[model samples]
Target: MAAALDIKGLKVSYGNIQALRGVDLTVEEGEIVTLIGANGAGKSTLMNTVAGLVRTREGAIHHYEEDITGMDTRELVKRGIILAPEGRQIFPDLSVKDNLLMGGYLRSDKENDETMKTVFELFPILEERQNQMGLTLSGGEQQMLAIGRALMAGPKLLLLDEPSLGLAPIIVSNLFKLIKRIRDMGVTILLVEQNARIALKTADRAYVLESGRIVAADRADVLLKSDLIEKSYLGKS
Candidate 1:
């Protein structure tokens, strides 16, 4: 089968700085493929570029054999490409329900309602706080809302950027479990995370990025046992 997402020789630059240098990766269907690296690894840049939020200066992005490089974000959304984004970019002023509804804005009222019900089932707290303002939610709740909202778009391939960034360790654990559940729902995932240990634990395969280039790519379990990975990312010897 063709890969769910594929990038070849992808390059992105910000003025004089190159964020991605000939990075190549592939996410097979129904797999959670994670990109893990340190602060300047360009993990977020790669996700944004894939989502069409940033322009690529070179290479191509293909989704299930479709060339979608440089496509507009709106069109990408319509094509079942959704990015939950970093920072849980929820609308501060909108109600939890409304914020989720915004995610399905491209769909009809009936479709949105059905998807909203599914999201509610996935995150019952969202239903409990349906009328509450987004700004009033806790950080973990906000993160759940962000993922729930992205599900509202009915994504075929989900792009999650730093989902475990600011949460407590316990919350991070639960979030990784939720991520696996999301993948089991038949949506392929391409995750970008700075939490290397957890990221490896959650993914089927992993890629290590350094200075915007791919340095290692292997099965997550194999990478987890690597001495070099332990010293650099896992903080273990």
Candidate 2:
């Protein structure tokens, strides 16, 4: 069977600067995979390239055996691949519920309502604040809304970028748990995080990216205990 998401020798550039240099990745169905590294490691670039937000300078991105290298973000979402970007990108003026509905922009099917029900179950706070504008929510709440919105689309694969960024440690912990719960629900995930410990802990598999290249890839548990974190992940070193 084909992997949920696959990238072969990918490379991306901006003007004359190369943001990703021959990067590669894969996430099997139902697995939570993470790419961990310090800032400027090309994690976001890879995510955007795969999500169809940025054009790839080189390489092919395949989703379920189908080539989707240069597909647009809207089309990718319709195909069951959705990305909740680095910063919470919810529309500040829209009601919490509306933001989620927009995530289902490509769907004409009534299953979207079911997906919204699941999102509410996953983040009860979002349900409570359903009528409130996105900007009024706290940073943590906004992040939840972003994830919930993505969930609203009933994605087969989720591309998450720094979901823990700027949130309190307690909230971050909860977010990580939610990620695990989502994976258990049968959605494959490609997570990019600045918080390696939590990211690796929640993920089934982990990869380390540096200057647009992959330096390590392994089962998550092994990565947590490895020398790579001690030396590379500044905080633990």
| Candidate with the greatest TM-score versus the true structure | 1
* Least well predicted 10-residue stretch by lDDT in candidate 2: 228-237
Query: In model 1, where do residues sit more than 4 Å from their true spots?
Result: none
For all predicted structures, in order, the TM-scores are 0.98, 0.97
Tens digits of per-residue lDDT, candidate 2, 1-237, equal: 899988999989999888888987889999999999889889999989888989988999999879999998888888889899999899999999999998887776587788888999999999999999999999999999999988888789999999999999999999999999998898899999988888988999999999889999999999888887767773644
lDDT of 1 by residue, 1-237 (tens): 778899999999999999999999999999999999999889999999999999999999999879999999999999999999999999999999999998998988998999898888878999999999999999999999999999999899999999987899999998899899889989999998888889999999999999999999999999999987998998743
Count of clashing pairs, candidate 2: 0
CA lDDT, candidate 2, residue 23? 81
lDDT of each: 0.93, 0.90
TM-score of 2: 0.97
